[model samples]
Target: MKYKSQQIAYWFFALCILLFALQITYGFIMGFARIGWDGLHDIIPFNTARAVHTNLLVVWLLSGFMGAAYYIIPEEAQRELVSVKLAFVQFFSLALVGVIAIVGYHFNYWEGRKFLEIPRELDYLVVVNVLLFLGLILTTLFKGKRQTTTAMVLSMGLLFAALLYLPGMIWFDSQVMDSFFRWWVVHLWVEGVWELIMGGILAFLLIKLTGVDREVIEKWLYVIVGLTFLSGVLGTGHHYYYIGVNKIWLVVGGIFSALEPLAFLGMALFAVYMYRKGEKKHPNKLALFWTIGSAIVSFIGAGLLGFAHTLPQTNLYTHGTLVTAMHGHYAFWGAYAMIVLAIISYSVPNMTGRKRFDKTAGHMAFWLSNIGMLGMVVALGVAGVVQVYLERRLKMDFMVAQEETKIHFVVMLLCATLFTVGIVMYMYEFIRYGKPSDEALEPAA
Candidate 1:
């Protein structure tokens, strides 16, 4: 709220909520398909729904991260955004690309890669869109009076993420080579640079909300960056194990991917320790809950659950199974989704001049969404274990195993319903915050 340009973030966050709702709708579609309810199979098949669901999740999070940058960079850099107009242009273009790519999926216009489903032509549009975004952020920082560590780390993360997208766009005839580079985009972003983005945002929030010294918090950020590179870089081997790579990857991946959780562990400890060490006078208790919750839950989801099947021996049986789904849900939710919500919860009130802190609905949204996701993960984990036992161990037919697993989908649907309800309530609260205002720059009395 310090600068009028910061209000641009409101629109991006709005887009984020809209896409997130769409994502949950598609998730419900897939969940129902799993249980033999294929009413929409002809119109929107499972593959289509899955693509929409996962892609929407990624888009929303990216939108949220962009919104976070727009809001944080102005304050951290001690100046207004360089060009608010360009930021809007970037935002709309990004949304347009997402909409086009998502709509195209129904018509089978995609690359067929797991996470890199957007067509190559649309990929170029995405690249242009991100370049515009990074240009606005980085230009503003350099022109400003100061460039804090928080701003630099965040800007660097955004830059690297943009650069990393190129590897996926490369044309490769060999499936193994294609898969190898695909992980450079997918695995490196989540396990690598995205952590830097998350850490930067977390540090900014802690300094503001927890009243911690900047020096103390930024020190932790350095440790996190170091740990992320140390493990996450080599951890790319985990995907190479069965992808026609050399046998050396088996050992490299097993040892390093196992160590990947340490970075997450460091994040959890950093948040908790800072929360305990700092003066907690911030009025936004709900934001505090989200900030703290994201840290702890990420440790469990990304750290512990990821470690569950990280080893070569365990992953051999569990690869491509529902086990991956279980980990994906919690890890993405805890590490990325929850942190996005946390920043939204913190920034919305300040930007919009609405003090809806600690509302019953807000707390309900937090707990319900988290608990529902946990239940869903448990159901998926159980289903994955049963599948590994029936198919991998016993050598049963795949169709038989899938039939047996249909019952678990019922449980998954129920949990998803709960999670959806929570999201609905969160959206409701977001709407209640109303529009941003120029008069809110002054501290609320």
Candidate 2:
């Protein structure tokens, strides 16, 4: 069932790793700056580092998702990619755009928007790149012998994700109008269609690693999708509550935001139930760990913690504070980042024909990274709570409150170093796998 065309994914994954390392570097810069270590303030100020850090997170995760698509679509569609050369072209174009954008960030050549900062000129190129990506994936799926639900769901997610980007691209003079539509892109992506993407990927991994029936796994997927749309779309109202929008959003947003956790809960329950029910245990235990861990941690990070502050009552105080950062870091790590690493863990072995699944370093990478991230989350959560009390409730000066939280950033940095070490171990394994070969495409004995 393996296709030679899947080899192209390896390159995208390599790019993903490179960008991720750079993201961590910038994250460290911000972390240190918080702790009064501003050695690179003149050359690369905190604002520039923040932009690079966040944007790189988005780019690298997209790269990983694209790699997953390239690998999964061929196998699920039961055919080779429609155009490997064009795929490579798409890959290189993506990397080039990302490089230009990240480099431009350092020079202040970006829009000041939070997530959508790559400016309008580069936005056009992004649209084209995504269109090309969609065209290839959809064409291959349609032309293939059979289009399974997993393939269709994954494809639908990708297509919808591309369409959703349009809202962020539109220009608006009013700050109210801009912020309103911005949530359409930001809130909707993470809570809405992106969940579809996560569900599809999770379904695929569950089917493979757990040896579960596709019928059963995909049935859970249908429920997950239903929950996601039902809650996530309306949940965008939560952002509208304080943003000069109508008051109706307060009620609407609170209700739906409360309901949002059900979608992630459904995902978590589905993964766990399938794992316990399955008879065949695949040897790729590390992938299983990540797959299962993604499901569980997402519920905790995205579901519970998001519900913690998303209510209008709570969000009023926590908005624009480090509390938001606490939620964001863990949610992204659990929902998107871990899943990407899971797919990489699963696919890399198959592509390279090397089964180093049981390495102690692999286990250490999983545990150390998870532990480190949890520690960081705790540190941020503690800092955020103190900030809320000092700055928001007590009306203390923001700078003074930030100074009070300096010690927490030191704790965050210590944990971040551990996180970086785990990632380095992961990169080591990826490099050790070397390149994919034609022999990998041949049937196993």
Candidate 3:
């Protein structure tokens, strides 16, 4: 039974690695569009690679989310997963559906929505909903105790994400309607529900790894929930600004999004404050690197950039440009990637029951990924600023101005290359010296 659970966890991890590798390759390939002109359309078109990139990000994120849920539910409940059978079934079902959807996407059969780009018909979409709902239901029943506020909030968010996704999946004749609902699922997932999940997981990890009492953690959880709902429920208005809507979204999005950064920044400060106040006997520094770094960078990248572009004044320059992509890349990294790294750090040691490492491989991997991402963020940001200067300040034609700053694209491509190399090193360390020794970290395990 133990072997089976561990095997399932690592198997999902292997999938994550594969997706990460693909994402890296496509990332580089897409960069070629800017730096060079190979005319590789139909093979690895910009649109095609972008779908791959975003979809892979979602899949790999879910892999980590599920794997962590499988592990933590047991520890909190004082029982194993209700049925490892159901667990594996849920995992594989997700994988199979992802494969089918992505294959269709690769063939250019998609409905042409950004996040909701899967080409599956309504029937297949329904199957996905059922699979997700069933998995959540089973996991919840198995969890037993309902008092773990943080975990429960996160799980409920996950469940609600599944539910919210259904309405957006309804087949529509007009592509615009499809596009609208697509944001419902896309923005609402990452911006709304995933933030709750992030709070839950971050709280749990800090409590366990930082040796803080559950009481202290739960207090923080309550605050987190308060801030998330206060900010996120209204903050989603940010997307409504440019989506061809007529609901006074500019005023609404601006006000709310201006407040949204407070939530992210709050989370970061809370994590750091708690870490400082709690125990300080740090283990392998890599284990907590992303966990801690995520809080800070997410606040700055997701929160601050969101603030920068929230205004109608600024977004007119930044919209659909490299600045927006910079925000996406960093926000995803700071929020999702950092959390995923923390989960791996927390789970891999427990799964392998290892305590220490001989060399600095894990640490190196952490720095590489973190630094690479930071590099991408800064480079892209500079290019974006340059764009604003060229198009807005200079009052030049759009494409003409964009062409004048071709050097920025080249620099951006170089940044992506650096980012990819970092992910490689990080993945290498994860595959190699993941677990140190059984005797050292047994108590935590």
Candidate 4:
């Protein structure tokens, strides 16, 4: 049942890896700047690097999601893609738009909004790119023999994700209004539909790797989706507590945001329960590690740390501090980044017909990257606490407070280097697997 169109995903993944490496490079730039190494300040500057670093994160993750769709949709729908040629076209245009946007950031050609800084002019192009991608995917699903729940859920997530982008694209006169709607995009995506995407992908991986019944696994998906929408939508209010919005948001946002962790808790328990319940012991242990790790870590990172400051009382003090950074980094790593890597680990072997599934290098990549990221999170958390105490509580000057926290960034950089090594090891495994071939599509004996 393997189709040649599935090969298209490999290219998108290649692009993903490229952008991720660039992201880490820029992250290092920002890290060094924090520690007083401002060699690139005149040229790149912290603002520019910050925008590039964050934007690249979004784009690369999207690339991974799209690649996952391209791979999964064909199999789930039980057919070849409606148009592989158009899929390639969408792929190139995506890379083109991402490159243009990154280059523009260096020259100060972007909006100042965090996570949505690609500018209005470029926004149209992004809309078009996403539309083309959606068209291909939906068309394939429509024309296919049967559409499974996993396929539908993944498609729904992708579709809703595209619709949500429009809110951020609109220009608002009031800063309050702009920031309000901006959370609609940022909070809603990471906490809302993105969880749907994560759930669908997680469901697929569990079904394959654990031999769980589809009905049983997908039932958990229903619960996860319910919890996500119930909490995540209203949780948007937490951002509005100090943004000059309605006072009602204080009650609404606090109550619902606190409930958000339940969804992630469900996801973690679901993955572990499914893994332990299944009789099949799939040979891809590394993929299992990532799959299980994603679930557990997301609960801790996104669920626990997020709840740590989500209450109106704590958020007032930690709103724009590095504490937010602490939550953001770990949440994204656990929720989105690890899941994408999990799928890549699972799919790459099947596509390339290489089963280097148990390599020492692969194990190193997982442990090193996770350990390094944990260390980074701790460093950022420590710095954030100090910043909040000095600048917010003690009313010290911001510059002085930052100087007091320089040593933490030094720790962050050391851990970041370890993370870089792990990623390099991952890239090595990817390259060694080589490219997909027609021979890989042959039915197994």
Tell me the whole-model lDDT of each prediction, alpha carbons only.
Answer: 0.93, 0.92, 0.71, 0.93
Candidate 2: residue 172 lDDT (0-100): 96
Cα deviation of 365 in candidate 1 (Å)? 0.3
Clash pairs for candidate 4: none
True lDDT of residue 241, candidate 3: 69
Q: Candidate 2 on 1-445: residue-level lDDT in tens?
A: 2889988899989999999999999999999999899999998999999999999999999898899899999889888999999999999999999999999988989999989999899999999999999999999999988898888888888898889899998899999999999888889889998888888889999999999899989888998999999999999998998889899999999999999999999999999999999875699999999999999999999999999999999999998899989999999999999999999999898899898989988888888889899999999999999999999999999999999999999999999999989999999999998888776786733
TM-score of 4: 0.99
Q: What is the lDDT of residue 365 in candidate 3?
A: 67
TM-score of each: 0.99, 0.99, 0.90, 0.99
Candidate 3 Cα lDDT to native: 0.71
Clashes of each: 0, 0, 0, 0
Candidate 2 residue 141 C-alpha distance from true site, Å: 0.3
Error of 2 at 287 (Å): 0.5
lDDT (tens digit, per residue) of candidate 4 on 1-445: 2887888999888888889999999999999999999999999999999999999999999999999999999988878899999999999999999999999999999998999999888899999999999999999998998888888899999999999999998789999999999998999999999999999999999999999999999888999989999999999889999999889999999999999999999999999999999975899999999999999999999999999999999989999999999999999999999999999999899889999999999999999999999999999999999999999999999999999999999999999999999999998999999998777895633
Model 2 scores worst on lDDT over the 10 consecutive residues at 436-445
Q: What is the overall TM-score of model 1 with all chains considered together? A: 0.99
Off by over 4 Å in 3: 1-7, 122-146, 172-176, 356-358, 392-395, 433-445
Residue 111 alpha-carbon offset, candidate 2, angstroms: 0.6
Backbone clash pairs in model 4 (N, Cα, C under 3 Å; residues 3+ apart or in different chains), count: 0
